[model samples]
Target: MAQVYLHTMFGNGARAMQEAAGSRASYARMEANAGAADMLTDREADFIAARDSFYMASVSEDGWPYVQHRGGPAGFLRRIGDNRIGFADYRGNRQYLSAANLAADDRVSLFLMDYPNRRRLKLIGHAHGSDDPATIAALMTPGYGAEPERAFLIDVVGFDWNCPQHITPRFTQKEIERLTAPLVDELDRLRARIAELEG
Candidate 1:
């Protein structure tokens, strides 16, 4: 039978469960909390630096949620002030889910992960799309330069660091290989068909 414990408003939820189980050695467990005292720690800065991509979640005018992957230079995220962060928007596919959502509602959430490090960062904030020259310059990278007309400014509110135990990292090279292998095979098959048709 799965053991059940009453939800407590204060204290660590994991601790409460352990206590209810009389500190039994058989129950393997760790701590869980809605708001922990040290939820945001020093590791967040490092995690953000290592993250190459992130999912940006926004809400549309009619209350629909949209999520898209935004990736660019390493330091796309900048610390504007204490407890506040800003990220530049790079050019993407024509579908601008994030931009449309920002226009309707500024409230947004960002989930960034460093596959190699297995670390993740969650950020809640208000975001705005911008075409400002300064902002574009700041976000541009060596090979992946940002378009002057396609950039955004984000204002972060709450930030949290999550445990990395469950995460598995996918390297940049692996991602590229996975994306191209199928296309290359398809091209080869198409060429064979073309040769047969010509013959």
Candidate 2:
């Protein structure tokens, strides 16, 4: 909790596995030497702002773990305070699995990824749903098609940057267009030159 993400993530089983794998001592040293892992810095804020999607994990009352994808326009998930983040819960299927799970257990885990850049951020936090007009407004994205039904406010307990191993690079439509703009322009120029020569 003080300065370690694995403190909130790694339990006895995880530690035992690390020990069996002969990596427990290194991880123990990491926990001891880590910086403030629960507080969000400008770097983290920027990363969160650039992300349009993330996976939220919750634990049901029945002890089953549920993972759901939450997404919107970039920066929908914004940092509130140094230790808090919130996002407007856009209208979806009537089933409120995430909201119900939060009511039973406030603890949540989040996976924020940047596939194109092969960057990943993992977070552990406590979250709750709020229907307050102000809270909802703060997290809302104006002119977005989806109607927000509520807001999920999360208190950060720990966060860590994950390794990019095995993450396949992918680009969104907008990103693909941006990356191919020069090629498109050259093609258009060639077409114009051919038309001029034929004339």
Candidate 3:
């Protein structure tokens, strides 16, 4: 399974290197055993629900790759189907590089990271953009405070989970507060006990 992901990544040169490293046979075994799915699993859906941002990559006609960070309220990226997802394209610096690139080439890649959990997901897809007001409205995040310029829809080709080898665990402000709440409460209790003893 996951032939698309492996095939796209492993060109002749890459394959040659893998062969030299004796990994080609192992990768071949993996490809034979692991087939790609058109739909997300329940776990993947939940992971997507918890993500507030992701990095997207698009390619220009000239073959240059552009990476952009897309962020909003959690769950801003709406899954329309098992194999489909979309988001409201909010107004930004107006570079329109991604939109322009998509016009030339539909292929796209996405990287979603959960730093605290040290998990990452990579997705490959073809993207379509729509300026239809209804579509934009449907995808827009209700209280995200961004103006929707259009809607970006992705028809997923495949997805893969990456190993957490080098990911540095980092906490957001909200995460830090949630994780330390119990400790803070214990500190308060200890202080109160000390005051009672002194009295």
- Per-model TM-score versus the true fold: 0.60, 0.94, 0.93
TM-score of 2: 0.94
Best candidate, lDDT: 2
Q: Candidate 1: where is the Cα deviation over 4 Å?
A: 1-43, 174-199
lDDT of 2 by residue, 137-199 (tens): 988998898889999999998998978899999999999999999999999999999999999
RMSD of 3: 1.7
Q: Where is model 2 more than 4 Å wrong at Cα?
A: 34-37
Model 1, 51: alpha-carbon shift in Å?
1.8
Instruction: Tell me which residue pairs clash in candidate 2.
Output: none
Clashing pairs in 3: 1-34, 1-35, 2-35, 2-36
The root-mean-square deviation over C-alpha atoms between each candidate and the true structure, in angstroms, is: 9.9, 1.8, 1.7
Model 3, stretches more than 4 Å misplaced? 33-38
Instruction: Indicate which candidate wins on TM-score.
Output: 2
Residues 1-199 of candidate 1 have per-residue lDDT tens digits of 1121112212477656766878733433322322222222345655665566788888888898888887766766655454455666655676877777788888887889877668777777668876777766765655664554555666555565678888987678866788799999999999999999999
Which is superior by lDDT, 2 or 3? 2
When summed lDDT is taken over every stretch of 10 residues in candidate 2, the lowest stretch is: 1-10
